[model samples]
Target: MTKVRNVGGKITETTKGNDNSFAKENITYNSQKKISFTSDKGIKHGKPETLPPPELPSKCKVEFRPSKSWQGEFGFDWCRIGDSQLPVDKPYSDIVGKYGAIYATSPSAVFTIKPELYQRHLAEYEKFVLSAFGTYYVPNLSLMKGEIAVLDAAIEIKENPDSMYYKYDKTVFEVKILEKLSNTKGKHFNDKVLEIKCLKEFSSKQKIELIATKNKIDNKIGQINVLPNNKVKEIDILFIPVEHNGSSGTIKGKEITILTNALKQAYVKGNIVRHKEKIKVGGWWYDLFFTKKDDKGVVSMETSNIRSIHRALDDVFFKEKDNEIYKNHYRVYMLTNSTSLNGMAEDIGKNAKVVVVYNNRNDSTAPHELMHAMGLYHTFDNDGLFTYKFQNTDNIMDYTHQVGKDRFSTNTWQWKILN
Candidate 1:
């Protein structure tokens, strides 16, 4: 038979006349004694019914004091065992002293966890220890649910700068997660997209006048809603110079002599002279007449004479009264004699437009005049020309003689205007 009795409010039993039973009954223990115990269920338990959580698992905290010897030096002092120093190879007292010496010599340093921050850290520490021990267990779901609440409270505390301690100590610092991300937020679309427009226009002719203003054209069309897929219809152009009448024909004998002499003088001076004549008289002239029947032709013709060159350009092809005569589309007028129709455009606004090179010689001159007929301008005038350095050569705009032809270079600005 077995007799049962309650010891320390727990049930235990013994068999009648068993030696084990007598040993169990006779075994006396002191209340203050620390001993290991095993229950009948074969479970081993620690001597203490409960234990204070690990004060320091891997990391520890210490109060920091700046050193008087240096402006940015610091020292540490342990305030509480669980709240301050962590358990490491060295005892808490020894570790704290060593850290203090290290802090005193170093510049500003950050102390990781604060005393009030320990609760959250301790929970994290428990997880770390469990993982280190290879124990797999789902954490308390309640803890996961409370994460956001914890973060919110921490943010509020961090924003209140006064809530943090060690206000005067510069060498020691604390960084909180919430404080680091305090001012972060989503960006607005307006902030992301910025609009900027830079526009410029240049021409060799001074003060360009518009036969039809852009506002007038826009107003003519009226306000029409433009749909995403719909596009503006193309229109025909008029009054653009495509071809010229002056490139051919025998001038009066005296005018021919004047043109011949001008050419010879330009050749002797090493300036690019267009004609092979020995003498030249009267001004040179070329007419530009465009032949495109549509409005697109007008815009195309407007681009000629970009650089300073002498020639007369007439837009007879596009401006003709009969639309049937306006199909030629393109023309180039070039004149290279200085005195032949020089500055002709300034004189007869009707018959001839001339670009005169007053006292300049360089191979760039002929090409420069042709470019003018093509609606191109000098490289320097528009702030678009880039040269390694300004040399004492003819200003592509100025009619000055250049010693050599190697002194010329063109950049994209000129190319775009020509095209």
Candidate 2:
């Protein structure tokens, strides 16, 4: 490989090979005269017994450099030659034309190299140098440890002032190579069903029974049955109060009331019944089966709420808005601790979605959380918009109850879930 060094001392690698077995020769003329050529083997066996000669003008000079590739199977070898500086009016073609014969050519059709052709060859050389060393002109190309190579080259120049003499020179090149790697992986998930159990104290108070009264528990259970494959199976909620009014008890009377009332509100007013039928719910410590055989298949989800209960709600309630197949078959969950939004749905559990709010809060929190549960991301997350700052305070996702913020913008990332 060819190694090039840049002005900044950076080295670049090229695809060219390192073999350099070449030579150069020069020819000069004092007066107008034709020139001849000869093969490296010094054998002149062609169609014509005598070869034609080239007409060289007065005071003209020429230089020649030949290069060959060791790996070349065909005629990939090439040569570069330069002529002495002459007036524009000089007829230089006549001189090189004769030299073509010596190099093996016919008299009637002598080959002559043009000035433009020479310029093109020079350009190619410059490009090769830049590619190998990283820069064409610089302070000096830097040579790395494994890049040095000895080259066998020659430069031939001919002048016209007096008897012309040819000059030859040799040079070496050092190169280096660099490599880089990148990583790009998307999102993924493994299980589907989310197991949940009610806090022990809440369950002991017959919270499920008390909540059932708000909207006829039997009727809601029937509605849950309507769900395909009885996707949502409710395991008896068991609540264990880790902390109760700074006292320890199997079941506290006041705690039961609070638990029952919370359940009632969550089921009746909060519309938990509709979701129960569509999602599978298990006791807090129950074994969750999230395999393909389960009614709720593989689920894709994201979450900020790490609480087990909230995660369970997400699996049971969330669905994607537009994803028809997975939305209909699987369950997604977005566990959130925010009390601003209670829960949201997209066609219920028919699509992959989220359940934003987890902490018990005011009624308004349900809608907001549900909005997120319905597969709606934050409104402020405008990914590629140059004008929008990702963490800006004005964004709706950043809005807090203290600010009395409760509005969804039409031009927000949240809209993507709907479409």
Candidate 3:
């Protein structure tokens, strides 16, 4: 025997076995394409159904508004039973999406008349939503947060004017590997390590010339105008320390200073500032400016750890926004540390421009993750896992050695979109 009941907006279905035992199941419905169901132990139970459930109306003109408990950042909820779903009976062509507007019926359930109709309608709907929200729509290019290794690597610098020399001295350039960092368990890889690898050596005269060129780069950074021209005033950052209970945050004053200075170095080194535009610290007259605490310790607050980092960010910073102060400015959430995740960002192109970094000493992580938030894709991603296209890792966007990070490639048009 099977029984169905509605608790909240979720539909609970139960089946009685021949032995009189019962099992409860949760069902998710998408009125357009399919139905998905899961069991109590967080296990998926069935495939999506192609047809709408008999309980759902075949067609309606009025939009299905969600109850207070159902409305969210995305849209109305279709799964819950309430007065919100009233005005349910109307002509088929009167709603916001006209012919087809797929809506969430429950937290996990969506409804639409036809999948094809929904898809066509969704594209236009997204444009409307974005236009209404005043979001900068970054097309095609997207990025996600990932981990990078900073192994103790070295490259030999020979005496000549043909290559890069060691920063310390031109005479003694040694190639060696030392300490290693990992983002995953047991498994470790040097393939994605970010370190300096010397190529050609420079003579004393060439070194002088290099210094001159660097000065010119600095001049350019100062002379750059605003966006579209590849230069911005500064990228503001709010560096708040999150503390829960008696556990103080791992970030310290010295560490924040180190990270800030490192980012300034990376901005010049990454050439994102020199090549594309001028990026500086929030208030430091460099690449970024940040918030600081008087005590040099994290601000401790008591909040539900229900969703942990994300929940904490929302509660503390209001909500992440783009250009919080000026153009090219953003916010970052810092946590104690994590083994699996060094940083994370949305997969879409520059949606929130928000970033999260741990209390690690890796300076490159800042520019790397910041670039990810800025909608820049890795130079070489999934080289082995997929069919290998770009195996080079010298660029900051690549997972290989951090040699060419200070230089931007010739053709990175995606960056122009953000500007």
Score candidate 1 by TM-score against the native: 0.19
Residue 85 local lDDT, model 2: 20
What's the candidate order when arranged by decreasing lDDT?
A: 3, 2, 1
The model with the greatest lDDT is 3
TM-score, per-candidate, Cα-based: 0.19, 0.20, 0.29
Estimate every model's Cα lDDT from 0 to 1. 0.24, 0.25, 0.30
Q: Tens digit of lDDT per residue, candidate 3, span 94-179?
A: 22221112212123323223434334323321111111122111111111111111221111111111221122232322223232
Shift in Å, residue 222, candidate 2: 55
Model 1 lDDT per residue over 140-183, tens place: 10101001111111011111121122111111112122222222
Each model's backbone clash number: 50, 52, 26
Q: Compare the candidates by TM-score and give the number of the best one.
A: 3
Candidate 3 at 235: error in angstroms?
3.0
Instruction: Give candidate 1's root-mean-square deviation (CA, Å).
Output: 37.2
TM-score of 2: 0.20
